[model samples]
Target: MNWDRIEGNWKQMTGSVKEQWGDLTDDEIQQAEGNREKLAGKIQERYGIEKDEAERQIDAFAAKH
Candidate 1:
């Protein structure tokens, strides 16, 4: 899905995101608020992964949800 769609549906998409990244806290997810870059950055911070890898993960997640 596109970022716009994801953002529009953020409230509903939270569970799916949580399922993918259970290590993320509620506050962190709320902070992301469905912005792709913010979510990627948070994922990078939480998982200690490279920014590119986090973006790739988010791309895959966008495909799924």
Candidate 2:
């Protein structure tokens, strides 16, 4: 989904985000606020992955749910 849709439906989407990035807390997801860069950045930081890889994982997670 697009960033706007994700932001608008954050309450519903956060669970999926958390499920995908299990290291992320509810507070971290809340801090993300559906910003693509923030989520990807956090994933990269937590998982020690490249930015592109982090984005791909997030996109896959979003697609799954």
Q: Give the candidate number with the greatest TM-score.
A: 1
lDDT of 2 at 27: 81
What are the per-residue Cα lDDT tens digits for candidate 2 across 1-65?
A: 66678778988988778778899878878888888889888888888999989988877776665
TM-score of 2: 0.84
* Candidate 2: worst-modelled 10 consecutive residues by lDDT: 56-65
- What TM-score does structure 1 among the candidates reach? 0.95
| Tens digit of per-residue lDDT, candidate 1, span 1-65 | 88799999999999999999999999999999889899998999999999999999988998887
Which portions of model 1 miss their true places by more than 4 Å? none
Q: Which portions of model 2 miss their true places by more than 4 Å?
A: none
